[model samples]
Target chain A: MAVYTEISDEDLDGLLAQYDIGQALSCKGIAEGVENSNYLLHTETNFYILTLYEKRVSKEDLPFFLGLMQHLASSGFMSPKPIRAKNGEFLQEVANRPAAIIEFLDGRSVKRASPQHCGLVGSALAQLHTAGSDFKLSRKNTLSIESWRPLFDGCKSGNPVELTSQLLSEIEGELQYLEANWPSDLPSGVIHADLFPDNIFFLNDAVSGVIDYYFACNDFFAFDLAICLNAWCFETDGSFNITKARKLLNGYRSIRPFSKEELSFLPLLCRGASIRFFLTRLYDWLNQVDGALVKPKDPFEYLKKSQFHRLVETVSAYGLD
Target chain B: MAVYTEISDEDLDGLLAQYDIGQALSCKGIAEGVENSNYLLHTETNFYILTLYEKRVSKEDLPFFLGLMQHLASSGFMSPKPIRAKNGEFLQEVANRPAAIIEFLDGRSVKRASPQHCGLVGSALAQLHTAGSDFKLSRKNTLSIESWRPLFDGCKSGNPVELTSQLLSEIEGELQYLEANWPSDLPSGVIHADLFPDNIFFLNDAVSGVIDYYFACNDFFAFDLAICLNAWCFETDGSFNITKARKLLNGYRSIRPFSKEELSFLPLLCRGASIRFFLTRLYDWLNQVDGALVKPKDPFEYLKKSQFHRLVETVSAYGLD
Candidate 1:
């Protein structure tokens, strides 16, 4: 729900001239992506997406995001491939911001993802891991283990415990425990750290496309699965649905089997993922700037989720053997 | 810039069940309309805009707005026609808000509108007035001369003169003048009162569509022209460009010739139009709600335009006679 940068018509004309897509017919700011300004661009020939990277996105990490999409597309994945310019650069400058044209993928993100949708997303996630294996670039997961404390410290001055009675100390305890027990050896790969339902498009009851790779980074492949478990398997009432979890994990396993060690690390990784989202959402909730277009998501949901994950001692709790 | 309502997939599926547009493929909230939550809905057959009317829009006036669009579309105008439900009603309920699916018009609004764009808009506006001549339903312009005082009073307590040196007294005097001298008879009809650049779309340099008819009402057709004069003729530096105004007036005259009375009232209508926008913008500026998505427009811009219009004594001042 953000379109921070407005690309002018002359700028768009100049941008379209660099590509073979026919003359620009329309470019509308899409109220979808929160991290970057996205436009649904229509040309004489086809519909494409023109994304302008905003302040929150790291400019240095864009090559990894773009390259990951290009690599996935080359591997016959249903992701938006960056359209190269006349100079063969996938990234170009528009309105002084890093902008690129992406092939438009048809389908809509499910609001309440069904078990079948979760299954498709899981299999797609596994496929993405396989496709991303041959990619050369890598970006460290900045929001992983080491960054949680600083993020929590940034918002601790506001006394975030007001959101929940045990919020402050609960987060502190989890931070200490995760820092001490963070996994060192696992099958690490490019992971979509934020593969929420909003980023996964389902058409005709199948995963049509995987979009929004801004949060893609180098992390344990199982960590990515753990993130999806937190994202897709929970019902709106703060309860875990075993059917969804089992279906998702089964779908992922059918494509790329998880190792015994990976399965063992799943509970800790899921707990970490929960706190990772909770801390960020809490920070944003506590310190939302005036007149921001996006409504800050409720951090308390993640708080409840993290609390639930704290009770899970084994993968069996998530409907996994 | 606004999508105040979020329509869930279940709700959307229920809504689409009453339509013959085929299964819903995608619905992305569009960052276009400010008054309503607009989603670009892609079905198996065609594309449409799912607009959920927000609070600012009066629910009672939905029929008039939808009827006006239906009338204009049937009259061969390039406007979004409201898609009727299987129950034969254009307006339906979605997420507890009055919602409708409008056939998506294919064009883009110009950012920096050229004089040629102004000319096309003027001609299109005249054509709209002609097409809307027999629209059965009628709505009063809620922001007309009678409403400016109340709107001004809403912001008067803030000592709004601090925004510009003579803002308070100027608005006060202009309010009295406009109220006392509003025209009694000058070719009144259904007028698109807010035909700003963003509301008019161009394709291949021709006016492809006119939209955002929320401000459409039964008013002096010349008043509508005056609104366009204020909207299209001003440069970013706050100077009124007579060339653009002349081209606009010429385009309008080419379609429907103005009466002498209409011509004589152009300056005052233009002045009244300036203040009408000034008072509303002033109200919004002085009383912006927290967490609102759209930024308040500068009220002083309209104040400057009103001051410029105050000096004009005859139609020739606007490159007309």
Candidate 2:
């Protein structure tokens, strides 16, 4: 629920002049995508999403993000293509912020993921990886295993009363284990690091669209699956649903078969993924911006997910043969 | 920026079952209407606004509000018509709150109003009043002159540090004068009690839609005009633009001619309208909810507006003959 920057009528008209999508009929601030201010833009021709990149997103990385969408979209992936301006550029400036007009895709993100939904999500994730394999631009995963310790130290420096001594020790132990055992020889490509349920839309029992590419970067393909395992395979009571996990992994392997090394490193990567989210969530929870519209997600949930992954020994624990 | 209630997929499907508007394709929470949760609902058929009435809006008043919109839209006003369910009910319950599906109206609300926009707004407001005159429902303006004193008392009880002693005394004196002098007899009808710039939309130099009718109620026709005078005629620098006010009044009179008595009482009603807004804003400012998404508006701005209206002696001061 964010609309950090309010665009004026003149500025909006100025933006529309750059595109040939007809005159603007309406542009409403949509309560989606916390990292950027998104407006559900309606033009005389059709609907599009007008996004103003907020401070959280680096302007230099926008080319990679927008370019990746264009690449995936042209490759027959479910990503919504960014509408190019008359100058043939996908990015432009609006209200002193980099803005883009994106094609509006029709699909609703599920609040609760069923096993079938998990299957579709898995297939879609693998497809995204396959489609972006040939993309030219590359960005390093800034929140992978290496950043976890620094993020944890930053979290600890805040003196968060919520971080009990026992919890702190648990996080430290998990960080050390993940850093030592993390696999480096797995197949790597562009991975949607934040492919949470809310970021994937479904229609007619299939994944209709995958969005919020701000977190997309070069990382181990199996690590992306690890993130999904933490995000989609867990129930409200903090119990892991192996059925959903199986469906997700099976669905992915069907699209792009996982390597032997990828299969072996699954549990450790899941642990790494959990800590990555946990630390980021913890950092946000501690350093929340004043009057931020988005509520910081509970970090303990990720910690519980991490604990679950710590108990897993092999791929079979995830319902894989 | 509000999405107080999140509708689950199952719940959304259930709600859609009652309506013949086809299956829900997407429902994104829209950052509009502070009092209610609004979703820009896209179905297989078309787009609509699905609003869940929050606690701020009284449940009992839903019929009057929805019915007024139906009446106005049917009478060819720009108000968005509420879509009735197959059961012939315009309202239903979703997420345990009263909900309604409304036809999506196209047009962007202006951040900065031009004199032409002000004129269009005036004509639209008069049209709304005329169209709603025969509607068989009446809702008392809850924040009218009768409620101002109580509202002011509530604000004072909070002991707001921002309400200086001088400002408090000035408000008290204004309240006393308004209560004593508020006219008892004027041409009355349904009024859009809150016709701020954000509530009106324009396209191609014409008013395309009028929305957020939650504040509509039975009140003096001239008092509604007074509200507009305060809202649309003010520049950002706190200076009143008389040319805009003139255009607004002239545009309004072109639709439904104002009575001499209504015109004579305009300045005093403007002062009363200012106090009404000032008190409510002050009340909200003092008793802000924790983690509220919408920021409470500055009450002193209305106080300044009230002071401007206080010195006016006649309707001619409003650029009227």
Candidate 3:
């Protein structure tokens, strides 16, 4: 749980004076995560999560996040809507941090996300991409494949420079190969870039809501699918779960059938997803300075995870050929 | 990195002063965690972690945890020692919660833990258990097989409940059978119950430090070995990794050879390990009453994980017999 701001009863009450949903609220710190701060809020009628902007979250992107929620909500997306303030604004200040609130979704994420649920999630994801196709704001996917080099550069360890350099070189080569061959002009829109197992909420065996929109941005929908592949489809030991993979893709294609181009790019997108997490882990590891209360996670775990993904790419390459 | 207490910069500096680590320290909140309020404290001397006790951690058990660290450090174990204050007391109060400062470990975990490193870790772990033979404390393995009944009771629910229940019933039968047959008293000592890949640290390709002592407790050392079978030796798809498993076991046996009784009890320990994590995930799923900052992990993932462990137990049972 990443909760960054505390919304006092008075503050929440003051803000709720305008919402149609009715009544003031009180909130407590939920958790502060690497990407966002969340507070759990209780109101007269319902529970909600109040998120404060973190460093990784840009304020300029606030509209995209809040607007996306409201848009989806208006479209009967079955997702939480961002509550507006008395001033008809989605953003507010809490704990000296910029914040917004969303209705708490009922239900929990599946432990083993079933093939049926995977299909449902895939269908819902396609719906999101299609619905968001014409969103007014255009923010590039911050965690995309092209972003890999900068992320790799963050691992500026003077020693073992060869390892870091080699990783970057490998990543750069993949970028060039993808850029030259990956399909462009495929239907594109805002995609949930980090649809890990922990993020999606399910109710009655159906995906009720997709939360955590901090990583949602303009990108090829397939890349989002790739992220989910790395996150949800893979097993603990990093195996490519072909059965689950097929269910996911089948479910997704039912709503938005893949173009030949998009299908061609899927393998590369999967490789990109693996590399992204790997680089982020490496960056966090290299930056572990002293006096931190929480231990920095091992970058090598993701590095090893990437190796598994690479094996998948090698195998899939042959399949495609 | 869950640190559960409200803490400040001054609090961190004061604790570091006791350690005489001559480091200027800053504390940052870790945003996403279920169990504790974690902070990354950076000091002038070196990076270290400060954890504020959250509700799940019992206050009375602090001594066992702190003492275990001290015991290991005193016995020349290459792990962090909880820094003591000017009063030479390891425990301190932070944000009205029990707090301790621990040395931050550097370097990444070996991506694919090599057989040699696995062997080294196995020997180090055996040595750790041997060293803790006389420590004056006792606590139940909070998530052991014995705890599964209560957890299953907690998780009983709607349509899917029957399937989960059937699994639990089978597990329960296994538990009863194990209890009737397995030896309990065989070279008992303190052991790291969750010695997974993420817990240990490597520096320059050597075991820099063993960490995440939150799950450490007094248990039959052989049980710890059984746990490693499921954790370190298993392949990606819950498959038995015979070669890696043999390497790990042989390495540990070389340091502290198991008694025949201990060898016979290994299968039960493996089953116990499966139930332990399964119950934990189940408990976590049931207990998520909303307002959590972190995403409640899928309890179902462990369903598959535990299934594999059960398989390993069956395999080990035959081999030992």
**Best candidate according to lDDT:** 2
Tell me how many residue pairs clash in candidate 1. 1
Q: Which ranges of candidate 2 are over 4 A from the true structure?
A: A158-163, B158-163
DockQ of prediction 3: 0.04
Deviation of model 2 at B300, angstroms:
0.6
Q: Residue A288 in candidate 3 has what lDDT?
A: 56
- Compared with the true structure, the alpha-carbon lDDT of candidate 3 equals 0.67
For all predictions, the C-alpha RMSD in Å is 2.4, 1.3, 24.6
Tens-digit lDDT track of model 1 for A115-141: 888889889999999999999999999
Recovered share of real interface contacts in candidate 3: 0.09
**DockQ scores of the candidates:** 0.76, 0.92, 0.04
For model 3, the stretches where C-alpha displacement exceeds 4 angstroms are: A1-321, B1-6, B10-23, B30-34, B157-165, B297-321
Tell me the TM-score of model 3.
Answer: 0.49
TM value for model 1: 0.95
lDDT of 3 by residue, A25-126 (tens): 333444434467665544566656667786767889988888987887787776688888767899887656777878766544555666676777778778
